[model samples]
Target: MELQQLRYVVAVAETSNFTRAAERCQVVQSALSHQIASLERELGARLFERTSRRVWLTPAGEAFLPAARECLEAADRARAEVAAASGEVRGRLAVGAIPTVAAVDLPVVLKEFRRRHPRVHITLTSAGSDDLTEQVRKGGVDVAFLGLPTRVEPRAVQSRRLARGELVAVVSPDHHLTDAEMDLRSLQGEPFVDFRAGHAGRAQSDEAFAAAGVRRDVAFEVSSADFMADLVRQGLGVGMLPAAYAPRFHDLRIIRLRDAPERVEYLVWGAHPSPAATAFLELVDHGTGQARDRPDPDGPAG
Candidate 1:
């Protein structure tokens, strides 16, 4: 009913413990519980099923959660819109990226955004490209940076290609097979350390190798770029990474591939973005000169 009641419900649902939820909302346990009880009486259904050990959302609560969240988001967006009308960008900006984000200097970009819009709060998260894409589409993330094979582009979101580069082999200095450049077949016998199966990072290599009819052994499948580099540097297996991203590990050696897979980095956002998101996007456009005039169409790669 009331916005404050919805906020309390959301807080309780997220924490799953009345006391912890009260602490998070900066309210006493008794007050929070009383408010939830009052709401339950008004709705004529229980929102949560509570036990001595844990609390969980009942069916009614599950149905109410989404609408409650949408209401909260709408309220926030209204406030943001009013602020923007006054030429002020004051809202939360959630940015997501892959672990090996190299197309843009994120630190410098975020620093500049903060300097210009001091009122906007920025949060950065790193995940697989597909996950970031979904988060953006679902409104969990305001903006995202993702990399996929050149043959494919992000689908179902507003996106622009920032840069394209080829994948290169990463090896240890002590490895015996030394070459300036080689094809995928040459590394067929070498064990590999790669991103997890189905991940955008791994998909490029997988599709390329499958197209070339090359079968390789993947010894380590990891989520962290640094860990993958560590494994390759120890000669556990060879790794494939974007040419731009591989240079960050100075201790590792980079070998160009004659038939390397190409990757395209993109900036993606939802159809309706917040004012803070709009401000950050304009700054990005000004810096890169890749304005929003040309937006990639929404669909999966053929």
Candidate 2:
């Protein structure tokens, strides 16, 4: 019924322990229980099922939890917007990225973001490019860095291209594909260690081979850049990585793919972005200078 009561319910639901929930809410167990009871009485629904050993949400509680969280988020955003108007940015910034985001050094950029907006809480998630794009579109992520093949674009969300580059082949020093430069056909019939079939990273290679009229085996479907490199180093299969990114594995030989697939890095955000998200876009685009016109909810997301 009230915000505090909702908070108590949410805390309890998340921790699934009355004592832990009270501790999280900075309230005593009795007070937290009383507030939840009061809220339950008001709504005429039992919000939780309490056994001595365990606590879990009731059906009513399950139904109520999402709206309660949304209310809290809305309130937080309202406060953050007020602070932003007064020249202070305070809100949560959820960032999503694929494993190989090479347009900028992420640690360096995140460190800078932290320094500039100390009050904004930040969280980062790593997933496939397509998954990151969907999270951005759904507002689960505030901003994202994505990589997709040249023929594709992150649709239904606002996106800006950061960089476009080709993927180079990496072979263990002992492999017999000795040419310094080769097309997709040169690597034909060779085993490849690539991203999972549905992942955007894998799609980049898949599209290339399909376009070149070649069918190759993705012998090892991995998700990590280091894992990809490791497999290639052991002569298990050939590895493909961005041209700029492959140099980090110094021991491997880099073969320029004359007809390599091109991947374009994109920076994406929701159409209606938070104040903290707007501030971040400004920082990334304009340096530490004054805030620029971006993350405008009224503006196009792309």
Candidate 3:
């Protein structure tokens, strides 16, 4: 019924130990236990199942957990907004990016962001686009640089197109595909090195081949672009990688797929993002100092 009670329940659910939850809440074990009991009594349902060695959430507790966290997060965001209104940009900004995209000049953007908002703490995470999108949806990440056609549910996040480039076929110098521009169907019989299924770029590659009505033999499924490029360099198989990454592999030949789809990047965030996230978005929108000084859609200039 009360915020404190909700906090206790969430802490217990997270720690799975009442004593540890109480310690995290900075309260005595008895007080925390009493509050949880009072809450269950008020709700007329047991929230947790307890045994000597472990604690687990009941069905009711599982259902209540998300709402409890949301309520706490909203409260924190309200405070963060007031801080932002005071022009004090001091909070953590959790940013996620796919490793392939990170290989691009993302460091430049991050440098500029840090230079302008030095007081804001930045945490960067590298993962596949699917994982990054999911992190953004669950509020684990404030914003993410993701490959386009994001796997995250549309309603849970919004995306702005950042950049678009082509996916090039990377082959060893001796490989036959290196000789000329070719159709994706030409690679159908070749052993290929590809991004793992469900990867952001893999979706594009898969769709391209499927649309062409040809099936390729994927000999290696890799998680990182660099590793995939290495495999191609060793003549293990051809790889489809972002064009921007072509320069990274000196031994490999980068060839354009006559009909391959272009790879796109998006800046994705939740519907209601933190102030630090909004500021980053603004910085991305207006890269120049003069342009950044211009007013945004919401109100006066930031």
Candidate 4:
């Protein structure tokens, strides 16, 4: 039977009189009687025994009353839950970010977002850019902080650049090259600690080196920026890292290369985002100077 049949049965069971039940249900008495007859026929049981002066429930009606009430309650709850999910701003948000962006930028933004929308539960994951992109594409994440060169399927995802951060040289303060800004050419033949292959930053570094007609003396290949920084601190080699990531360590000198191309971080999502995700993108775009009509490609100047 349809949900309306269940509802009508419950209303009739509550009132025990077809006239009163029809009035309560806002339907004609004949229509209510016809629907109730259809419901009982569908169930193969008479729900009510009717005489000229009295209306009374049969054993079948008594048994069906509680089940009908339960079905109506469940339908109501389902509607309420769906409405809450669509209209309320409270829910879980699964967000993914590249390791560097998660370490350097997400903490502050997430703090503010939590303060503003306290009811939203957030789950954050940090992985490589390629991995994060795959997570977003697979519907595993609601939103992601992904680096450029992501292979986003057309019409399935959209991206907004959030900030532009450049690769800078990181070296111990005592290193010979630590005192001055170095060009990509200057890094030629210098001992370097590089990221593992398939990393966006590593690819960018390789491109910069190729453009500058230089080769990196890669002393070690590591996956994490913090580890690379530690290697540089030990004077193992100089390394190239995002500018925002360089400030996390002490006793390390950060030098901007004169000719290094900038790397940009983007907020990526399925074509449409939830309200909470959209709000987050707005805050990031504003805070990072990416919201302006003519946003500077390098972000706001320091």
Candidate 5:
């Protein structure tokens, strides 16, 4: 029988009167009675005994009442769960970030986002910019924070520049060059704690040095910005780092180099982002620059 028929049976069972049951159900008594009669006919069992003075339940009606009530309750719960899933803004979001950006920027943004949207689950992964870009392109992450000079062109993925940060040279406080801003050429023979070759920061560092006609003596290669900073602190060599991240270390001396290039960090995604991803992007937009640049899909960059 139909769900409404079971509802009518339950209403009548609860009220013990056809007229009151119909009123509770917002239907006429005759209509409610007809539906109950139809249900009884389908089941081939009489659900109610009628007397001149009152109406009473049959043995079958007693047995069916609990099951009918359970069915209605289950249906209600199913509807509620579906609505919660779709409308309450709950889901998992996977985000990737380059080591430097993750170290300096992501913590504040993620903390505020969690405060505002407590139901959304988040997973974070830190990698070099090149690796993070591929993760976004291949759908391993819903969104990513990356620096410029993307390994794969922007056309294959969507990206927006979030912040323009100046790159600076980080050195131990006791180093000779730590006291003053130096020219890019002055770093030619200085020992350097370099980022691994494939990192975007390393690429930018290499480009700036080559353009300025400076050749660096590599002292060590490390994959993490934190590790590079620690190495610099131990007097291994001067390392290049973003200004925002440089302030985090108290022992390191941060100095700006003349004609040093600025780096742009981007929020990259594959195609359109999901709802939760879009919300997180909005938070990023408010924190940094607006998302104005839409990469041209079939252009030379792809």
Candidate 6:
């Protein structure tokens, strides 16, 4: 039956008078009586026994009263929850980021976000740039920090540039070209340590190498920037990494590239984000989300 029908039944049962129940419900007595009669016919049982002086519940009314009251209470709670969600930025937010970007200043931004909206439960996931971009496109994650090789023209989703850096060559401290500024062609015969083939940074490295007409031996491939940096430090091979990420390792020396790919980090989100995600984006737009863009002096800036 309808919610109003249940409400009318409960009110009549509690008041024990049809006129009093109608007054309590702010409806005319005749309308309330007719609705209760319709509910009884639908249930195939009389709900109340009425005499000239007063009214009393039948067995069906007694059985249905408790359940009717419970339904009303549940409806009230559902409405209250929707109202609260509309008014407050409170919920779980799943944010995605690539490893290199994560190490720079993403953590600091999230820290400030949590401080302002304590009710938002933040879950930060680190993945490759391609994977995170796919997740954002599929609506699997609320927002993401994506490293795009080229400038992104927004379409299905929105993007705001949070930071930018140029890709640089990383090598061991004692390597011959550690202190030299060179282009991709200089590493022609050197063993290279690079990210996995499908990764965004790796794709950029491939493009730069192809443009420079250089072919270096990929001696090692790893998914993590830390691992790549360690391999370079151990003299296994040289690595092409973002300038913002190259400083994470102490034993490695960063060299500016003559033609390095520019990596633009973006704050990307769907067209309509959740309240919590929207609030976090607002903090970023207002210059409070730790907007960081430290370009290396030796490399081209975005």
C-alpha lDDT values of all predictions: 0.87, 0.86, 0.78, 0.73, 0.76, 0.78
Q: Write the per-residue lDDT of candidate 2 for residues 193-275, one digit (tens) a residue.
A: 99998889988888889999999988899999999999999999999898877888999999998898988877899898899
Considering summed lDDT, which 10 consecutive residues are worst modelled in model 3?
A: 291-300
| Residue lDDT tens for model 3, 1-302 | 88899899999999999999999999999999999999999989899999999999999988889998888878767877899999866677899988776223667777888998897889999888778888998889998877653222223578766555667888998886645588887787889998888777688888778889988889899988888988998899989877766667888888888887665666789878888899888887775322111122222111
For this target, which candidate reaches the highest lDDT against the unseen true structure?
1
After superposition of all CA atoms, the RMSD between model 2 and the true structure is 4.5
Which scores better on TM-score, 1 or 5?
Answer: 1
Residue ranges of candidate 3 with Cα displaced over 4 Å:
1-5, 22-31, 41-44, 102-104, 111-140, 149-156, 172-186, 210-214, 249-253, 288-302
109-152, model 6: which lDDT tens digit per residue? 78888887787778988887777877877666788877766644
Candidates arranged by lDDT, highest first: 1, 2, 3, 6, 5, 4
Rank ordering of all candidates by TM-score, starting from the highest: 1, 2, 3, 6, 5, 4
Flag regions of model 4 displaced more than 4 Å: 1-87, 102-104, 149-156, 286-295, 298-302
What would the per-residue lDDT of candidate 5 be over residues 1-302, giving only the tens digit for each residue?
A: 88899999999888888888999999999999999999999999999998766788899999999889878855754554564567654455789988777222577777877877787788999887778878887666888887764233344788775556567899998888844687788888889998887667788788888889888887799988889988999898999887666777888888888777566677788785666677787787665323233232433221
What candidate 6 gets wrong by more than 4 Å, as runs, is 1-87, 102-104, 151-155, 289-302
Task: Compare candidates 3 and 6 on lDDT and give the better one.
Answer: 3
Q: Write the per-residue lDDT of candidate 1 for residues 1-302, one digit (tens) a residue.
A: 78888999999999999999999999999999999999999999999999999999999999999999999989988999999999899978999989877767778889889998898889999999899999999999999989898777788999877767788999998987789798999998899999999899899999999989999999899999899999998999999988878888998889999989877788899999899999988887776433222133442221
Candidate 1 achieves a global lDDT of 0.87
Clashing pairs counted in every model: 0, 3, 0, 0, 0, 0
Tell me which of candidates 2 and 3 scores higher on TM-score: 2
What is candidate 4's CA lDDT for residue 268? 80
Clashing pairs in 1: none
TM-score of each: 0.92, 0.91, 0.76, 0.63, 0.65, 0.66
Q: How far in Å is the alpha carbon of 129 misplaced in model 6?
A: 2.0
TM-score of 1: 0.92
Instruction: Identify the runs in model 2 with alpha carbons over 4 angstroms from their true place.
Output: 287-301
